[model samples]
Target: MVMRTLAASLLSIGVIVTSMQVSAANEPIQPIKPVKPENAELVELGKMLFFDPRLSKSGFISCNSCHNLSMGGTDNIKTSIGHKWQQGPINAPTVLNASMNLAQFWDGRAKDLKEQAGGPIANPGEMASTHDMAVKVIKSIPQYQAQFDKAFGSKEVDIDRVTTAIAAFEETLVTPDSRFDKWLEGDKDALTKEELEGYKLFKSSGCTKCHNGPVVGGNSFEKMGVYKPYKTDNPAVGRMEVTGKEDDRFVFKVPTLRNVELTYPYFHDGGAASLEEAVEIMGKLQVNREFNKEEIANIVAFLKTLTGKQPDFKLPILPPSNNSTPKPQPFE
Candidate 1:
């Protein structure tokens, strides 16, 4: 009689678990849309510029140097390696799915990808090249001029055109069709039991307040330490620099969870060496809760499901510099 009663209870539990899985299709997190470029030639031109190191004063660093497509669109370092090997102030954010971000940079300085693409090249600590120099170098190359004419209907090379092409290529970097996305699309077997539970906890534990939406986090800005203070040796004032407002201090754009499994070490300071540590730190500081080892593991498993199909394209072959091309000053 006791064995029969135990079997009945187990059967009842199974039904409840199945119901929960079905209901998960109604969750707010949306799937990423696959990219379809409107202008293939323009995108190809942008791809060439993205891979060309001639944009930098040293002719050694390209957009791919920091935001490597092979490594989840980030350099995967504590901070980026800059011109003269200078250390960057903050960790490099992933370029993948970046077009979905409300604003660019940790501080949300640039309004769009086009604006953001121009920043690093002119920054003294980064590529260390003036916009004029970059344009001059590109304009001097006859092959690039022909390609630009094909792309824009004009052979005039300028900073605006350069940045516009780069932005066009970056827009194609969106990733879609992750396991979590498959689950969201009503595939019951897409996520395991633990991942579903983790998703429930992720929403219930107040993580969804900031981490919701299509990209799972890039839509808003939040304080790094809402419940407590965040300690970091890296001295970034966050949005305060952009707004000149005291209240905006320590407030930063919440990074996207998409492909986060590959974009590490985590956080703006890149202090958390592993996803488990990052999750624990966020729970205590951002949500004012502590997660145990099992919970952390489950949450991380769910987070890993955010990894999707990365962009696939052939490596671009940059046009060679002509005799009139300005020389890059590596030391100056």
Candidate 2:
């Protein structure tokens, strides 16, 4: 038997596969739809751009370095280590259904993927390059310059085209074919009885208030400690840092529960280590009740059901050998 790697542990956080519940009371939860292959050629081009390390200051790290599709779209670190091995203050969120979010990033700083894509590449702690530097680096290679023109009709590659290509690729990263989706589609026998019971406990426990709907999350932002503030001497200034509003302090986007099984070290801060412990912490910090071991176990089981399927794409063979001058190495 193959031993479970970080991927398995991330994917098996709970016990069963599950789906979003739609009711008459409010808007239906809709998982992000897969991007139409309307332009298969562009998607393919975007795919290469997405994987090409040439976009980064460090030749070694592509978008995949932090957001591995096989690894729940996150590298499972509390905070991302960027260029020069510098640590980002915020947790690395999964990129799985990020296109659905109204704002991207833990602090809700970015307005769209096109906007979000450029953040890390130039963050002082991340890829660390100016727009001019990045454009110049990518354009140094004739192949990349040609691909840029092909992808965006721009012989002169700029920050806009680069981020657009990456964002276009991200729009295609939706994962919606989990067993839970199958169950939602009328496959009554898809989930086991225990898993079904766990789903009940998940809702009754009030997890669904903030965690319901498709994409499972990605709809709204809520303060972490709704009932009571999470105790911290130096809590990460979540939404407040962005909005500069005291009321918005500690607010965070409710993350999609899709593939929650594989994206553990849960919560905005990644303080919860195990599913049970995470549940325990949520109850105390947010829900105001201690979780019984079995209930916690069941909730974990239901969360597993949210692990949807994703399609694999081929990685780009690099050295960007076809290109002329190599892009500047961001992390090197």
Candidate 3:
């Protein structure tokens, strides 16, 4: 993804994505850059919390349930079915590169990933449980209590530290290289001619305005109907739900285009089912240009090139132990 468009986000009117002058109807109205942390302990703690499903009301839905490392870090469901089979309105966003986001959630409601991680547990439509109750349940298990002691040096569990550990883990969930990244580093063979042409069109067509940066799009939020209204039978008001402003209505976070192919059911609302259809919709909604069949296909190919091998991050097993003996498996 391009960097400039992501700097300040696209929520503001007339936000430029870059300094370069282009003929696209909309151009760089913002700037962006890739960023990372220099810490260690928090990330370690976050990793533990990420895999511990005990935080959920059902004790079955870890962050991994929605953001698996093997599948672009996003659950494929159009909307995740949570506790008691409750359905959410939007598709799950990939946690693969969520650490880079300026605001969490499709509506930019949470200011950071740390803040976002703690939200669902008590959300009536999501995890639907209180921290006090959740901690009581997990601590009841001897294995969990021991693990918490080792990971956080405590005899008790709490929600704040739980989210801290998960956020730390999320910070490590980044994909740094792909065919596109290789091309950016000056490897001529990294991208195919068709992919290169698609890349050219991607930038020239004004997608870069809201879809650039290291995370590709997570860095900003924008009106979904800038060029055309996104057609829908069940419409969501998006950011306006949080901001309570008329203009913010239907404005959702611009997801990072990274790993676009593996993470399907696109957009904040998951309106267009396939990437091909999603691209076509973007053509009308954001770019105001109609994509020909070949153009759409080429764009899909280029987007596919954005995807790389699945990220390999094995979740650490729970219950840190002091014994030197080898751990036992379920078979034993």
| Maximum-lDDT candidate | 1
TM-score of every candidate relative to the true structure: 0.92, 0.86, 0.81
189-299: candidate 1 lDDT, tens digit per residue: 999999988888898999989887888989998888999999999899898989999999999999999999999999999999899999999999999899999999999
Candidates' C-alpha lDDT: 0.91, 0.74, 0.72
Top TM-score prediction, candidate number:
1
Off by over 4 Å in 1: 1-25
For residues 131-193, could you state the per-residue lDDT of candidate 3 as single tens digits?
A: 776566555667666656766677566777777667766877777667776666545677788
lDDT of 1 at 25: 42
In candidate 3, stretches whose alpha carbon ends up further than 4 angstroms from where it belongs are 1-44, 140-156, 320-332
lDDT of 2 by residue, 1-332 (tens): 25457446545764223323322234333433556756555566667766766666776667777887779998887777777788767778898878888789877889998899898877767766667776777777677667767766667778887888878888888887677666666566777787767777777777777877778777788888876677654368788899899998889888888888888877777776677787777877777878888888887887788787675777665435434454566435
Query: Candidate 2, which segments miss by more than 4 Å at Cα?
Result: 1-32, 232-235, 319-332
Evaluate model 1: give its TM-score. 0.92
Span of 10 residues, lowest total lDDT, candidate 3? 24-33
Q: Higher-lDDT candidate among 2 and 3? A: 2
